[model samples]
Target: MDNQALSLNNTIVATNANVLSMLSERGKNIFFPKLGILAQAAQARGKAINATIGEAVEDDGSSMHLPEFDALVNMPTANIFPYAPSFGKPEFRSLWKDSIYRKNPSLKETVISNPIATNGLTHGLSMAAYLFANEDDTVLLSNHYWENYNLIFENNYGATVETFELFANGGFNVADFGKKLNEIEGEKIITLLNFPNNPAGYTPLVSEIATIVAEIKKVADKGKKVIVLIDDAYFGLVYEENVFTESIFVELANLSENVLAVKLDGPTKEDYVWGFRVGFITYAIKGGTAELYEALENKTAGAVRGNISNISQLSQSMLFKVYSAPTYEQSKKEKFDILKGRYDILRDALSNPKYAEYFSPLPFNSGYFMCVEPKKGLVAEEIRKHLLEKYSTGVIVLGSVIRLAFSAVPQAKLPELVENIYNACVDLDK
Candidate 1:
């Protein structure tokens, strides 16, 4: 149909506000497409979410855990045998809140009372999508971001994702981040920033976080609610001089009533309990008392009720044990140091002349993965395939860039592992 004809056929409802229009417009794109990885996951196939979503089943053996994988997942009896609350176990939520606020003492008095638990980071992400996203509201995101965020913000919530590149050449891009803020004028937008990124592992420095707040303030100055969702999946793993805590979470609160910060983070990446899958949604509503907190909590619970029903009872039960454990921080800190050790080795080896010339590190402070923008002629996939097929090594490809998970490989094996990547690239050059 012609543009004029299409316009003729559509009637604008007088009461349909700009927010609704924005929501409708944004709901039409593929920001985050669901991955086939879940098709292979037991929970995806299990009665839990499977029954509701009605996705096709893979097989029955999935019900019985594979022996080797089962052994690694050895949780205390409570974690395995019991059920958990939908929101979260009370004590677990309280302890988890203590873990969050205690990390940032500057905000000991800051009231962030409502914390909703999810099965994992993804669950909290999806819940955020469900809660704030309108029919097609724009969810502004960092240019280089976690892929799965697209699925939650765009695919599921009916939101359009806008972006600004977070960094360049191993440093933060404050100007670019500011420019993106200037571009938005009307409509409700939820701007999300993920740190210790999935592919890049870029954590903004303290100055960078301050700069981000200043930029966000410019937007909120225009009377818009800046719902800045911070995905802190990899927390307490800071290996560099970076702004690592509730800086934005605290700053956003002081900025405006229009500024509501939703922090989507969890235990999946934190406790070395990947399979345990416990996460939480924390709201940082500045200057709000019990009444405001209650209202927000009610809405948050409504979002949980509408979307997920509740986080797993079993996951919550187990997390409570970890919460109550005396060695929680000490044990967790040791694990973080271990992942940190692996990252250090990769960082040191990446400084090698041979590999250093091949790529530049995007601003990375801490996280499992790091991205490399291939120099000149090398395509990310081609090099990735070359590495995998010939060297029997694996790496993830992101557009023209390649992402390496240095944290997963053992610290002792990092030298040899990097050598494999280095050698593969050299062969490609030849």
Candidate 2:
């Protein structure tokens, strides 16, 4: 390992041995070089005779860019063209950190590492897996998950993904979660928790969140190390009153020294900037200090530097501007209301007795989608094919369940979409 990596490992070990133990082999060897090109470039920043980096810049310290590309965005060319710091723009990182506190009020008193930018939530998860997941390591998640998780964690990193039934008795299956955690045979456990879960779109209620936290803590209490990756990609999209509005990260952050919570979230879904490809990764653990977090941040930045080098400067800059706008919250609420309207239509449509015979709707109150399992003697893929061919409707089929994205359909078209799905199932059954 490089001396810098050794130094970082020592620092992490000194602060919290459990955290150091959770790192994978690659993570242990990865370090942000303090004497590298980026470091020298930083030292030469604002110099009268600086030529440390490769990017072309005018003598007046302005970024050189084509007028055609520069005219597209209203912002300055420097913000659009410059290479963002590997950890992300300092101002933007701070702004996002503040927003986390604002959105998750329970985290105001808690201490967490500053957020580091990623290309998107998927990249954020890949980064976390790079840092913590070792070959043959088991990743626990809900059975109803985003399929890409298998590509990111298992295929990319060679980790094993074990699943627990996502729902039991019309809510989160806390018992199954605890059972799965206990079944894993190791002192180190990594789990990814995605709320407003993909496909199912279910967010746990407050009591459910409390129970989930308790279950994680139980594992931590057993002298085991736990790394919780909270994927809050579809955060702040809840339509129902009883759903847990705050992130479960708030409870997991300071739960135990044996547990480290890494939160992956960004503007993709929260601010309706899906194409921006900007996301963030944050760290928190019990008794974590500023120095400890800084060390982790450096390692995380090293990972970022090694991977994509850095996120897009234009995306980060544009989002920073959007976040600063006075109308940002109101605009987000406006969009949320539209999605909630669609959700209401789907929920009411699914409640009808006619569709229940063909398909059973899963419990869902948040996020972009909800799933339904075909009734007995019906095949989900057959229904999906029937929908596509007969009705020109598209829906995702996973095993026996079909996922419907209410977010994609117009409010007026949601009922029709649901009806088409039901018709497809009936056609397949016949």
Candidate 3:
């Protein structure tokens, strides 16, 4: 009779009259305490996390001559310290165009430049939901997504987030993705695909990438609007041979006119500059006027101006300087090598026959984290809890999987971490 029992027993269908009454008054849903907490926080404009945000400066305390950084700090002309134009600085946006090409030259014909800088990728995501997604639209999400995406789409935008498996037997499962695509009975189907994916650490094979683009094209050819959002938060961190070295944006752009690809990427992970908070949103339309591009840019800027005013000009300045450096690629490669070293340790540690059968890799080829699926019959959460409470080693849990980030763990401490985790899972059978 009460709310608790109604929720547990799934007896809400009998409340049709009550639901209709509430809907007419715009009080259409029952209250949950977490939603109330969120409401209060939103009313406060995110001040709860204010003190923790640092306009952080990085220094080793040993290098007095920040030769490059000095130029970055003292030599910016327009987009430093002042308010960035709602769309962004014209110079920075132009530079961003050049940067995108340096990696994916094929985007010259397919993608357009309607970029808006956000404080971070999360802001870009919020804008994505607002600009395109209708309230009751369905978002076909990758099976293993970044955990918080649900809070944004389902909670914030009132859209259904469905899942399509990223892989089946250690590679992209074309059939699974196609099956899910067919099930969505809508003209505008939206999907969020994260590469160098969050927990799985998998990227599509070139053939698989081709298949994906082709299928999205198939959907678009049916006169449907398909928005393929490529979350490249960890772009360019490839440590393996065939796991998509190119951005998915390149693949999507090659598809039909109806396929709109939005890429959300940032300096946070790739540049090893977390506090810099420099991120951008880019749209790849099949065709558009420069003025149409400008109009979209203005709308995006409207969102930026409404949310955080603008991203810090100082961080943008610093990153632009880095992007211009001759050794930028070399510097990025050095860090990638370090990450590869850490992942190597994790791979070898897990390969020991003693622990090999307990779990499987999420086709891990790139990115900071890897997904660990429990062995047949053993649930992922049980193993995860066993590891943390028993070993004091913390890790993230995603449904029936464990997300192990090799980037955060030091090389020396890694063996111990994996050993403890494996043994914990082994102990689970007891």
Candidate 4:
């Protein structure tokens, strides 16, 4: 049978045996291609300013300024080189749960279980897709989302990707989301939410988050299985006072038995250890028993074992120490302050009157990046290429909008970055 028929018939499974078949059908995606091409160009052209990359770049254009978990570096050979358990160390899991509560105090009353270790947030998401989503399942997301999700749900799991408007009237379109949920013809539907959202770094208002939870519960009440995967890769980076401080995981977790809240987060962006590649997959199933969580853990561990055998022991050990450190909270606060300062620069720069003719900045106050919609008669790809060829500037082009990784751009160089973008618009116009 042809690939199309296989996909239509739902015969292709994302298992080791059918890997080739799955790749033939759903593996083609554009995120990595654009990222790879621009990343290579950015590196090859020395002195080029690359804002397309997502990792937290130092203000001086240096490498990621990660936390100093020096104790791990000097630890005994056994601690650094030994294999981590497939499910992660018991103490490490416990420490992570404690850290989660500290970061999200709202989750303190929302009975939850320990998180399972994954290679990173991406891996955690991939595993969740494999375990929960099936071929032909519909995974819903915001219109403004990280493109890797396409690779995870549609490409890898053979699931259908649906989207709802991320914003309406300068706020989250909760009504549209609910409408989309009801429209999807499936008993099982997955909603993947990322905040502070990538590409367009916006966190919803607290009431907006509550509306989302209520919508999910309404669907669950109608006898549909809903998986709400909270991608908190950029957690705790909110700048505005109105935005919710806690992860929406707590509220969704308390909603209904048919609703499952899966949180994917890591030290990559949170702790500034992008290279460490340490992350977690935590669960919140309403009225879930301890036994159920343990089974979920084992299944998740099995998925991890089959995929990469196990994550890096060195990374896990190092993170374990950081989680248990006496000054971990203080260290996180210091880093947050730095990112917040950079965010302020981007916010002020975007608000300048000069850029209004070029593009309109989106509503954003948190996260590492923000987005802008180019004026009419302009194409995002054309603008991106013009910026690269004419000015040696690199930014991501997503449909009609362009993303600026202000987090990667230096504070002093912010003005120059803005000038370059505006200049690119002028050059393209000419």
Candidate 5:
């Protein structure tokens, strides 16, 4: 390991030995290069004769850019053209961290590191995998999880994915989850909890979340270290009354000395900025201090530096501006209301008794999608193909379930979409 990496590992070990033990070999070896070119350039920031930076700048230190491109975006040239800090733009990171507290009031007293920017949630997940997932290590996930998780955790890092049924009895299968955690044969446990889950769009009830937390705590109490990655990509999109609106991160953050909660979320899904590709990763551990969090941040920054160099400065700058606007909150609420309207329409349409014989709708209350499993030996893929060919409707087929992204459909069209899906299932069954 580099001297810097060793220093970071030592810092983490001093603060929490359990956290240090949970790190992958790569995590323990990665460190932000403070003595390199970026460091030197930062040191020369205010010097009269500064030339350490690589970007083209005018004598006055203004970023050189094409007038055509500059006219396209209203942001200052410096904000778009300059390379962002590997950890992210500091001001934007601070603002986003503040927003997390605003969004999850339960996290008010939790000690979490400032958020680090990434290309998107996928990048954030990859970063977490780099830091913690090792070859052959067991990673617990729900069977109804986003498929990309396998590519990131198993394919990229060689971690073995162990899955539990996502739902049972029309709700989160808390019992199955506990059973999976108990079945793991190691001292370090890594699991992902994605609320408003990708395909099912189900956010657990508060009591269910409490039970989940208790199950994780049980593992921690057994002298095991736990790393829980909370993917809140579709956060703040709950359309129902009884859902656990606050992130599960809040509950897990202060749960145990052996538990490290990493939150991956961003504007990509939450703010309706799919093309912006901006996301953040944050860290929280029990008994955490500023120094300990800073060390973790430095190590994560090093991973960012090594992998993608940094997140897009233009996207970060644009989002920062959007966040600063006074109308930002209202604009977000408007979009949320629109999506919630679609969710309501889809839910109502799915409730029709006529569709019950074709397929069964899964429990869903929030987020962009809902899934249904074809009934009576009907294959989901066959139903998907029938829908596409016969009705010109498109939906994703994941094993035994078909996923519908109701958020993309207009409120008026949602009923038609659901009806077509039911018709397709009926056609396939015939």
Candidate 6:
């Protein structure tokens, strides 16, 4: 055998021999960071405020009253028990596609494929990673991204992540983004964009969104294949009037063939059904065909078949009924208003002068959570533990930033929650 061939064989065996090494190089290096301990302890301790989980809750801290969706659970027999197609129920796929475009009317002229169902938005991203990226391929993401993306893209798919600073001057950093895209020359790239972003909870302004679409087109114009995945998991939850209201996918879909736009979204956050696990992946390739979509759908279905086989039938059935109902619009608005109330209360409370001594809030105009960078070199992990043990308040701490999911916190409780956080930081200073 050739010397190079023998060396490659030896490396493969060494990697497979160590069970941990079977994971991609990136996976072997991850620490599986967790901060759910506070949530768990809060439950056991009782009356502990939970600012951890992102689900919406009632004023008394109970789960949101979703009487409107009760009928979804009692669907006709065929909807409940039988297995669904690996791709999804055809009607559900069509309905989801219609719903997406209906909400974002600017996409009416764009060439886009029908939506394909997955277990959740997370699985949709995983499927996209499997299809577009290969071992050691680079994925450009913002530095402040959801933690799960690491496991899905890098660990499982063996892709390497390249990060650009997510914020500059309190907005999207277009110049830095363009620089990063140009730096890695002559490679087909996969770039991920998440709006109503997790942890930070900021969506781009209209001008920023336009720049993002233009930037990807420039990359594609340079003859490099660019797959842009838009993670719109927290779609349409914006609380501000000035922020861009639609998915940037609409403009991107109309761009060059070299750029493929894949949108990952679901009813989990939109419909307030966190446990439903019903999400979709829709693609757009200019001048693409039904046959092309079918081919792409088959590969995604094969992945789902080999793994979970299919998403839960009951979940899809429930979502279908919810989508089909005439009252769905009104029901969603009711829940949105509730979340908006909580969002506004938190915004107002954070504006209090007293809290400024502890931390400064980041740019947050939408979504479930808002992040803060603590003052005085305070460590987020230490403050998290101090808040849990001393004040019985639970918040998610990521590195030096602290994230509070106001969606789960009642409007009436906002003042107290802010007070506890202030106290926690002051006590830690001593």
RMSD of each: 10.2, 1.0, 12.5, 13.5, 1.0, 14.3
lDDT of 3 by residue, 1-430 (tens): 3343234123222322211111111112221222343345446543534323213323431213335555655654334544555566667777877777777776766547556887778778877776666677788888889867888777877878999988877788777787787788866778888888888888887778888777777777887777787888899888877677878898775466566678888778888888877788887656543543444455566556656767887777778778889998898888888999998898887777776677766678789999777785788778778887899888888888888989999999888987877788878877
Worst 10 residues of 5 by lDDT: 421-430
Weakest 10 consecutive residues, lDDT, candidate 2?
421-430
List TM-score per model, in order: 0.80, 0.98, 0.80, 0.82, 0.98, 0.82
Weakest ten-residue segment in model 3 by summed lDDT:
18-27
lDDT of 2 by residue, 1-430 (tens): 8999998888998889899989999888988889878778889887779878789988677898888985589998878998899999999999999989998999879999999999999999999999999999999999999999999999999999999999999999999999999999988999999998998999999878999999999999999899999999999999899789999999999999999999999999888889999999999999998888888899999999999999999999999998899998888898999999999988998889998788888999999999998886888888888888999999999888999998999999888888998877777666
lDDT (0 to 1) per candidate? 0.68, 0.92, 0.71, 0.77, 0.91, 0.77
Top candidate when judged by lDDT against the true structure: 2
Q: Residue 143: error of model 3 in Å? A: 1.4
- Count of residue pairs whose backbone atoms collide, per candidate: 7, 0, 0, 0, 0, 0
Better of 3 and 6 by TM-score: 6
Candidate 2 lDDT at 240 equals 90
Worst 10 residues of 1 by lDDT: 25-34
Task: Tell me which residue pairs clash in candidate 5.
Answer: none
Model 5: per-residue lDDT, tens digit, 325-344? 99999998998889988888
Of the two candidates 2 and 3, the one with more favorable lDDT, higher being better, is: 2
Q: Which pairs clash inside model 4?
A: none
Count of backbone collisions in candidate 4: 0
Evaluate residue 144 in candidate 6 and report its C-alpha lDDT on the 0 to 100 scale. Answer: 77
What is the C-alpha RMSD, rounded to one decimal, of candidate 5?
A: 1.0
Q: In angstroms, what RMSD does candidate 4 have relative to the true structure? A: 13.5
